[model samples]
Target: MNILFVADPLEQFKIYKDTTFSMMREAQRRGHEISACEPRDLGWQTGQPVTGQVRDIRLTGNADVWFTETPRRLAPLHGFDAVVMRKDPPFDAEYIYATHLLGQAEREGAAVVNRPASLREHPEKLAVMEFQQFTAPTLVTRDPAAVRAFHAEHRDIILKPLDGMGGMGIFRVREDGLNLGSITETLNKDGAETIMVQRFVPEIAAGDKRILIIAGEPVPFVLARIPQGSEVRGNLAAGGKGVAQPLSPRNREIAEAVGSALAPRGLLLIGLDVIGDYVTEINVTSPTCFQEITEQTGFDVPAMFVDALEAEVARGN
Candidate 1:
């Protein structure tokens, strides 16, 4: 089997922590020929799909790491059995363009995971708003007046970029917050990128939950990401600590609902964020937590993910 991973440069990866690295390692272990090319490498030449270069990849050491050898030119989307869109994102125009190219590939009979159309259509935060009944009090707006009103009503609010990943640009404002003006000014500049403002769930002081879903089924383990001292962010990138925990009944319910809703759309793999009982985010763009979950639970989630991909490949055949 041949697999193509559409991702960033190899040198940019932190082998121990990157989920893409793990996925590549697992695929290699299973004897699949793995290759990589950046999204920008995709293009159309004389009405046929083409790419700049593709490199064969392999794991190098005791760690589930990755190293790519020399690159070779290949037909754009025809040779690989599966293409994993594992690029990290701010979901900008380039990301949308890459999805368009991958969607074209899928139409031409290649299996593109997380279906490209769904990836373009579903902005993680906005897509889950359909399940508002299960989420916290949330608002999406760039208007300072509207944000201030929401803060006044909720007394405590969390603000984050509507299109952010890995918990970047997230901020929390208390009941008597003093920096709302400056914060909103900085975020809402540059032609009106709205922010997500939600009523802060005090239960987050305990920890936020990360649930991994594959092929519409919950993976059976959850990580409670506890924030460091005086911090409000629960992202491991933000100094949070990850502890293995079993899913509560409520957590299982939310995961099931979200997984079932998203699976058929080509979002075959997802990491859902739950703070307390409220669903805060649905991470589709290179979602993490696989390493933490596997390390603590010994579940071999990377293998599970490979199984899902292989199934997709079989279906395509």
Candidate 2:
């Protein structure tokens, strides 16, 4: 099988931690072909088949410089047996445009992981509203007044932009609310943008657990990203320490509830962000933690992902 990964620059991958690279390695182990390109490389001029100017590469067992370039060319996404939309997201306008291109590829019968439409329909920060019972009290609003009110109500809350990733632009407003107005203004852009405000989950001290669901089935272990000193964000990018552990019953419950509903909608993979027992985020755009979980739990996460990818491709055929 041939797999084309729509992702960040191949040269920039931290192979030790990047989930996309891990997936590529696993696929290569199974004798599948792999190539990569950033979303910017995708193009769909009038006469093209929703094409991407990608670099074909094969993975090597190197701790550094893990991939060797084979060739570079413009090809229709449908030429590949599976198209993995593994681009990490701010979910900005460009990302949305890329999805439309990928959606076009899907229409042309290429199997795209995490269906393009589902990526558009379910923004990570906002998708939790679909499973309110499993999520913390969250408010999505642009109004500074509403934000202030929520801050007052919850006493301790987290405010972040709708388009943020890897804990960027996140703030915690405590009861005293030292910087509430300024933070609200910055995040909302004077009532011009929407943001999410959720009551701060105290259990974050333990860890913010990332539970991965593949093909509507939960991975048995989760990578619990524990925040470093004086940080509230448990994102590994934010310098959190990842600890892999078997998923608790509540974690399984959330994954099962959310996965069962999303799988039929073409979401081949999902990452559920659980704070305590509540789901705070549903990361569909390139959900990660493959290396961490595998290194600690002895679970072959990337191999499992490749297995699911192969199944989806065959099913589509």
Candidate 3:
């Protein structure tokens, strides 16, 4: 199988912790050919299928330089056995444009994981709104009055932009409401943009748990990213300490429900961000923690992912 990963630059990957690198390693170990390209490399023309300047790569065991690559050459996306969309988000216009190209590639008979249309449909932050039954009291609005009302009712709340990633632009307005108006203005851009406000779930003190669901089934272990020092965000990118642990019953229930609901829609891999018993986000775009969980729990997450990917491609064939 030739697997082409549509991801960020291969040069920027921190091989020790990068989930896409882990997947690449597993696929290579299974004797599958590995190729890669950045979203920017993808191109489409009227007469041509979606094509990308892709390079075949082999993993090197070196710590500093982890991979060796061939010179890039243009290839139609459908030529690969599987096209894995592992691009990280702000899910900005460019990313959406990449998905549009990938969607066209799928129409050309490419097996694209977590289908491009599904990625467009499920914005990680806004995706949670669909499953309010498993979330904290959440509100989405651009109006400062609505945010202030939510803050007043909840007393302690979290405000975040609709498109933020890696914990950027996240704020907690406490009971005192100091800077509540200011934070709202910053997040919502004074009625120009919408933002999400949710009642702060204090269970965050334990950790923000990342529950991975592959092929509509919950992995038994989860990576709990515990916030360090005075930070409210438990994202690993925000310097959270990741601790791999067995999934709690509540986590399992939420993962199963959400996983089953989303799997049929072409979401083969999903990461549910759960705080305490409630899911905080549905991370379908480039979900991580594969290396952390596997290293800590010996669960072989990358292998699981490859197995599912292979099965998916086989089914598509």
TM-score of each: 0.96, 0.98, 0.99
lDDT of 2 by residue, 1-317 (tens): 99999998887888889899888888998898888888999988786688888888977798776778966898899999999998988899999999999999999888898899999999999999999998888899988888888888899999999888899999998999999999999989989889999999999999999999999999999999999999999999999999999988888988999999998899989999998999999999999999999999899998888889888888888
Tell me the whole-model lDDT of each prediction, alpha carbons only: 0.84, 0.91, 0.94
Across 146-172, the per-residue lDDT of candidate 1 in tens digits comes to: 999999999989888876776788888
Model 2 off-target regions past 4 Å?
none
User: Poorest 10 consecutive residues of model 1 by lDDT?
Assistant: 62-71
Across residues 1-317, which tens digit of lDDT does each residue of candidate 3 receive?
99999999999999989999999999999999999999999999889999999999999888888888899999999999999999999888999999999999999999999899999999999999889899999999999999889988999999999888889889999999999999988888878999999999999999999999999999999999999999999999999999999999888889989998999999999999999988999999999999999999999999999999999999988
Among all candidates shown, the one with the greatest TM-score? 3
Enumerate residue pairs that collide in model 1: none
Candidate order, lDDT descending: 3, 2, 1
Q: C-alpha displacement of 214 in model 3, angstroms?
A: 0.2
Candidate 1 versus truth, CA RMSD in Å, comes to 1.6
> Whose TM-score is higher: candidate 1's or candidate 3's?
3
* Candidate 3 runs further than 4 Å off: none
Cα lDDT of candidate 2 equals 0.91
Q: Count the backbone clashes (under 3 Å) in each candidate.
A: 0, 0, 0
